[model samples]
Target: MSESSQSRPVKVTVTGAAGNIAYSLLWRIASGDVFGKDVPVELALLEIPAATRAAEGVAMELGDSAFPLLCGITVTDSADTAFDGANAAFLVGAKPRGKGMERADLLAENGRIFGPQGKAIGEHAASDIKVVVVGNPANTNALIAAHHAQDVPAERFTALMRLDHNRALSQLAQKLDCQVGDLSRVAVWGNHSATQFPDLTFAEVAGSPVDVDQSWYTDEFIPRVAKRGAEIIDVRGSSSAASAASAAVDHMRDWVQGSDGWATAAVVSDGSYGVDEGLIAGFPTIARDGRYEIVQGLELSDFQRQRIEASVAELRAEREAVGDLLG
Candidate 1:
């Protein structure tokens, strides 16, 4: 749309296009909110066969919205078709935990979904394709996908921890009686689950070190951020949609463009802070040249170390449960 357009349209494939999160995310991306106005994007909407028709309806709405940078749209039930030539992908479709379902059951169900999709991405997507897993059990789902997508660099596969990162920021902002923009360097470590640790050890507000009460940080702030999704579902009668979509956009945008400061993402660990190597765990990260690098060498207090270790153990157990699926 702009005269100074620098490159061809990025082909982005989004699974679960018929769902609420995708519903919110598609509009943001199509409107050039993620990739900027000067860059164009073509969307490949992937849905299950039962949901393909709904995905088509969503495409029709996109057409009606008249997004200037949306060059194309394709709705498909096939993962191979969806990932074809894709430069970016958001794996948002996974089996949700139904009544009476155990955690292992959820992991195996999602592994079945992501493994095939990952293989499809490996065979079909562009060489530089980057992927984000937005579905529940996201960290392990990403690990499964990365294992199957052997051709794609494992580091390119990340889970959506930015949502937790943002939750931590918002909670801390409220506690400090300051705007969210006034905060910097807040990092979420470990799984994007109840075990997550939203560390403010190095956080700053208005260029000053954060000095919140220790009991508040331990008793209120950490659990609040870690379990925010469950809290949202409890209060709203449904899981988060728009906020999750926004965080996905934030994570992908930072990965594609760059981060202004430290952002939290669930990237494959290189054993930083004693997280298991290859575990997709949340860490303080910076993006540059379209790659996320974990911010290393930060001192961890004993409490923080224990919090992180507990989450990593959960991640290890998950990997074991899906051992049959991984290569």
Candidate 2:
């Protein structure tokens, strides 16, 4: 905490501090892209025991940057240590699906990682702690974390669907020849995987509805945004790094500071739009006063309903696979 600042420094903990995404993400939070330029941040970075040295090196770089808003840094291998007294947390580390690995295996492995971390968060984090899970299969990972964190409100936990949301915006912008800012009510629904539906039903540019061919929306836009991560991996030879980091920043920033228009995020479903209760599913929401209220009563076309149902089915399957790990 700095006396010159308006408030105490936000203790923001980030997992996987040694990874590429964290490398980009740390700078954003430290330099105040997340909580605003005036708000100070005390960063607590978490890594596995084997990556401790590498995390320390990253900390050294942060020191060199001399970001004015970064008041303190703590690099540790202990989740308890990383989350203790934290105000916000980014759960970004998970086992990547290796070649020939089954989906069930991946879910079980990530369950083990998030389960204990969630317990630690419940035990050690601040009462108002907000968590965003950013690893692969983020929605399920978030569900496991939230289920284990019995004391924390389930609404406080979310997964990063902002990447999908942003990807949809960019793809639409390119097609419509409009700035991304011109598009409003653009949303991504369902899983963050290829099954996600990039809804153009309500998209508008300059306050006018986007009038594009239905074939382009289905054949080109949907798959493009849904498969963008794999496309990035194919070209860049790495999973999305900077873009994923940027989306994480956007998700947390909007959640903390609020947003003016609709923002898409994967939150615990309250049976909205027929999504099963207790499942973490993507939805369009309004964030205000540090809370997200799911947009209600939008009439879905039959096609939209079917698409969302398929994605939610995937989420339900994931939950079932990791049922034993849920606390």
The TM-scores of all predictions, comma-separated, are 0.98, 0.98
What tens digits encode model 1's per-residue C-alpha lDDT throughout 234-257? 999999999999999999999988
Indicate the TM-score of model 2: 0.98
**C-alpha lDDT of residue 247 in model 2:** 95
Candidate 2 global lDDT: 0.91
Residue runs of model 2 more than 4 Å from their true location after superposition: 1-5
Number of backbone collisions per candidate, in order? 0, 0
lDDT of 2 at 95: 95
Clashing pairs in 2: none
Q: Report, for every candidate in turn, its global Cα lDDT versus the true structure.
A: 0.94, 0.91
Query: What local lDDT score does residue 196 receive in model 1, on the 0 to 100 scale?
Result: 90
